[model samples]
Target chain A: MKTRVETVAIIGLGLIGGSLAKALKDNGFCREVIGYGHREPSLRRGLELGVIDSFTLDLDAALSAADIVVICTPTLVAAEILVDILARTEALEQPPVITDGASVKGNLERAARSACKEFPPYLVLGHPIAGSERSGVEAARSDLYVNHRVILTPVAENSSEALALVSDMWAAAGATVVQMTVARHDAVLAATSHLPHVLAYALVDALAESDESDEIFRCAAGGFRDFTRIASSDPVMWRDIAIANKAALLQAIDQFNEHLQQLRRAVVEEDAAGMHETFTRAKQARDEFAAILAEREQAKTS
Target chain B: MKTRVETVAIIGLGLIGGSLAKALKDNGFCREVIGYGHREPSLRRGLELGVIDSFTLDLDAALSAADIVVICTPTLVAAEILVDILARTEALEQPPVITDGASVKGNLERAARSACKEFPPYLVLGHPIAGSERSGVEAARSDLYVNHRVILTPVAENSSEALALVSDMWAAAGATVVQMTVARHDAVLAATSHLPHVLAYALVDALAESDESDEIFRCAAGGFRDFTRIASSDPVMWRDIAIANKAALLQAIDQFNEHLQQLRRAVVEEDAAGMHETFTRAKQARDEFAAILAEREQAKTS
Candidate 1:
């Protein structure tokens, strides 16, 4: 089998970046894995951990030798870096296919379009739906993307060859590639990812500032712990996500607020039947989601 | 060491009830374990599973044979059952010391006081801060309460001896007992447990009814699964809990709404600093809560 990507460049050297480099190296998906980051220590650590064969601080040098580039910086920083990379790679005889691991797509796409006049057809927007509460190169793993969904939102300007290269790269990293429009991707992610993160942070912040904070947390058991687990996620990263996907996230917040208000009314009015109806519906939906995920895992293993 | 109680009766052979029976039987907290339930099948299953040495549908018979009775029914049902038990035990020569595993404490305490002219000093209200998303006797485990917190809210009418007996029983079941007022327990639980359940149910319910329901749920990953795991919990049980602790739960919902609103505004206004601060505070608080729980677990093992 001919490899779709010969040499890959990963920017950021964080969890996603380092993990992708390691997965590519372990799977023999590419001939060389080059890591680039503003942090000298993280770049060195990525080399020490065998996440990359070489390290570079210069974006032009990294882009010059790469067949594909995976941007893994935080959302805001990723947008800025993508613009810089597009400008640097424009002069290359064969500019490497570009993609990113950003959680939000709409803002990044707009920023990319505005940064370059031609808005390179090789730029394929992507997000790998896998991460942990922990961050940085130390938390990266070779199997992080295995069996996980990596959504690709390819624009009209994207060439089919570029899309195939980026998709194949993610497949090589052990992720299942799914394609959708940018709007649909942002809306669905807002509901599933961004909304839940906001709710977790808000719930924990509310409880933390309460008068009985000590007792409240002391008595919090498994359910509370799991429910708020995402509250312990990287704050700056989430802050950027919340800002980047502002419109869709705001709409999600409104919808959730409406549902919560209905529940609050039910509780205040002591409407047991209404409360039961809502809770039962939620359980059914949640159970169906779990069943689907289980089936997917079974399919992957079997 | 001598067993604190020679005979124990568990009413409503559901998750908590069956688990308590198993724990008591395993720890030898009592010589005889009696199970009572309105459902004959669960009662029979309790005995067949060795969760109970005997089974009965007769409340009076079970109460008479018990040295201590642990009521583990839905909040509303538990309140009604407690009243019925208090009424029946009034004429007894020596009534069994009473405790309950109801999630909310205030309403149950009020109902107990109102049920009889002289509220029984033997009644000690408690809630074991342990459970699973699954329910019924089939999900019961002997180690369910191991290293878990059991909050006991003893009113002025509760005798110290009765409190000690109930506390010791839970201790024997591998739980650490903590004391608080009924108001405090209800308030703290509203902030920690009930509010989180409501948010989870509401979030799932909203997404389930959306046009992109399938896509939204299909892409939901580990965070969504864990965050909504409690949404799969028994609906009727949570409904009763929400209604039982209406005032405190409503207040919690309101507080959470305010915090959520703050976050929503930050996103809408593109206030990165405000969102970062909120997420950072939540991360710090959640991490501290996790650290405290880990410390408690370590102390138990060490």
Candidate 2:
């Protein structure tokens, strides 16, 4: 399915929202993209860069004129915004369809349920499996979501029309939309994305503040720096994610900590066989991951 | 100072030794380069790939005919080989100047002290700060060490001539030779190299063995895959490094675990400010690291 709209209002215009606006305009998926935010410089920049057709700080004005609204705030704040959006639209004759680009989906779903007293048929929860350590409208590009996966966790309360429209929008943006439960999405993302980030940040902070910081960093190689690359991601954004997806991320950290302890014990005891087995298993899995990625890349090209 | 030799014996015909052999031969720094290892297939591959001029199964013959020897086995095994080489040549009037590419230095120093009661004058502990996740002689390339740093840990007992000779050898292979104490080398490498490897291996192993592994791996993106790329490195080699650098690595792990637990507490308690502060620090450090690397890269190109 492909989607087109008369106008699209993008709330909280950062990298995610700005990119979506640019992509929508470039694909002619919408006649106009209205950027809604308090960041005057970025909003002005978005208008100047042609990423958005107009800019406004008035939420009501942007929402009333739009056929669709995409909330793109940090995860924790996005839930609050979702609640507010649902409440204010309750009296409308035909409310606009609403979707969000939060990394964690459960909080938004909960907020919607709390506000509406039932699942909001007009509201759909989605997460784009795309981002970078960099942020802001200044970094926006239309191709960010090209060939990326967008996971949509549509609940039973979601109207089929709304779900289809959201899916169509992502498809129009050059993304492959997939469906999953909110629980599954959070858990999988915890292990694959959030957990690695937590570990990387911990490693970087630990090494940087150590007594031998100078020598340690001087000897740090390119691979080691790359391993901690995600530590450079937006701090406030990650903080909200950690709080929003608390339980699953904690479980992920606990599981990884256990595995780390096992390896740590092997090192302490000088148990050569134990360490070798763990290392070999990890190597095999990582190698298989590389092969799968290669196959996926080849399929996309060929 | 630049030095040349009639023959150079590399005691382990793997990626490191083979690359050094090829580089030495390509630079015309030595008349003959010999590979000495028990892995017959890899030794044969080295010969066929022109990575080594010739190879011998007889350690005694190789050592006797060479003016220099480079022990390039895994860190743990390298210690035993060093001890054996030292003992076997104790009676020689002028034994070959010996160097090694073991990632850990303290174990070799301890092994040397235990066997000979003092650090041998002809031995210089060195580690080339270069490698890939891939292994074997077939992966060897002559330019692997070009523009890379190779740290040499030379003790007071090391003869100046022996240290100079080893420095010249690394220089001939296009590596920048830097000197530091053995303890500093182990501690710095523990935090920068060994600790990151341990964490990556643990993350990969934990995710692969979990029940949600299928979904986790399916959702894993390019960045996460590259985050664990070091986990695909040679298992036996990492295992040896873990055992050989046990004390320093354990200290590094303990420090990192403390930072991780602090961050975990912040997440569990929904302490946004605490998490934000830690994340901000980590992000700053990582950003600084990236800038440093970029500056170094610009210097290289300019």
Candidate 3:
């Protein structure tokens, strides 16, 4: 049941919003796309690229006409934007089906529930887990979300039509839609994504300020190059992730710390046998992980 | 000045030895190449691949007619083999210039000085810090050393001719030869290479044996994959490295621990500002590192 979402409003034309605009418009997945950006230059760029049918910073004009509104602001400001939109639009006879493209969901849920108490319910939570280290509207591309996972966490007893429309939207953008609870999503991402970033940051900090920094950096090989590539990602974005997924990210950090301490103990004690066993287990685990990735890749190709 | 060497003996047909054999023979850098591998299959493979002109299990036969002998075994076994070769060929009228292609240099220097006292007057320590994750003679290639660094450490009163010959061999193999003190090399590698391997191994070990392993791994993206790729490297080899460079590696571990503690404190306190600062510094450092790598790549292409 594909509902006709004639005019889709995309708020905050940064990387995610700008990309969505391009992907949906270029693929002919949407009829007319409306865009709202904080900066005038980004709005102009999106318009020049034909990613949006029209653009404005006027929240009322964008929201009143939208059949489907997609919020794509920074993580820290996502809640505020949603609350303001819901509050100001309460007098309207009919409101758009609201969906947010924020990474985290728990805070968004609270903000939405508080602001839209008496209004027609129209809220969907989604996280598109795809990106490049290069960011912003200049880095926008239609194929960024192709073959990536886009997890949607809809509230219980929600409008099935709205959910279907949101699912179709992501599917049209070339993403696989998987549903999960907000808590589960945060924990999984903490272990898989956030922890790696934290460790990479720590490793770089450990080496950069050291005495042999120049020598070690000069001789840094291919292994080091790939391992630290993600450490160059936008810092403020990671800072928000660490705070938003505070509990799970802390658990992940603790787990890695324990592992590191054990390795250090092995080196300190010169326990060759113990160290060898640890390495063997690590090797086996990586092989298994690689196999899983290979299967996913094969599936995509096929 | 290029020095003439009639025969070169490489003991061990694994990645290092087999690669050195191929590079020397393919480029006509040496008159004849002979090898000794612990495994029969590897010896056969090396001969079949033309990495060695001939090979013998008898150690003396491999070393008797050699003008230059390269011991390319694991670091743990490197000392013992160098000692055994010197004892067997101590009575030679004119011993060949001896060099061992080992990662660690202090132990090799001590062993070479102690064992070859009655034998070769020429001893030099060399480390060609270039290789792929793949090991064994099958992975050996003539271009393994191209555009890579080869560090040389010469002891007090070490033969200038021996040092010159070894340097020229590596240079002819397309490596940029650099000289460093043994202690400095160990310290530099400890921070740049050893610590990262330890962190990668620990991170993999933390997840490989857990119940949440499947979920954690499923969500892992490109960053996690690259960071853990080196965790799949040979355990025995890494174990030897951790043991041989214990002191320097321990210092590096301590430094990394301090950084980890800082991150832990920030997370525990929910200090977003602190975490952002740390990540910003790391991002800048990685950018600088990437710039360096890109410059080197550009130089290679041009």
Against the true structure, whose DockQ is highest? 1
Per-prediction DockQ = 0.88, 0.80, 0.77
RMSD of each: 2.0, 2.3, 2.7
Q: Top TM-score: which candidate number?
A: 1
The interface root-mean-square deviations, each candidate in sequence, come to 0.7, 0.9, 1.1
**Model 2's TM-score against the true structure:** 0.93
Q: What is the per-candidate TM-score for chain B?
A: 0.94, 0.93, 0.92
lDDT (tens digit, per residue) of candidate 1 on A138-166: 88899899989999999889999999989
Rank order (by DockQ, best first):
1, 2, 3
lDDT tens digits, residue span A127-218, model 3: 88877767777888887777878888877745787788888888988888988887777777787788889989998988888776777788
Q: Give the candidates in order of TM-score, highest first.
A: 1, 2, 3
Q: TM-scores for all candidates? A: 0.95, 0.93, 0.92
Against the true structure, whose lDDT is highest? Answer: 1
Looking at model 2, give its docking quality level: high
Scored on chain A only, each candidate's TM-score is 0.95, 0.93, 0.90
**For model 2, how does the per-residue alpha-carbon lDDT over B258-291 read when each residue is reduced to its tens digit?**
9999999999899999888888898898888788
Candidate 3 vs. true structure, TM-score: 0.92
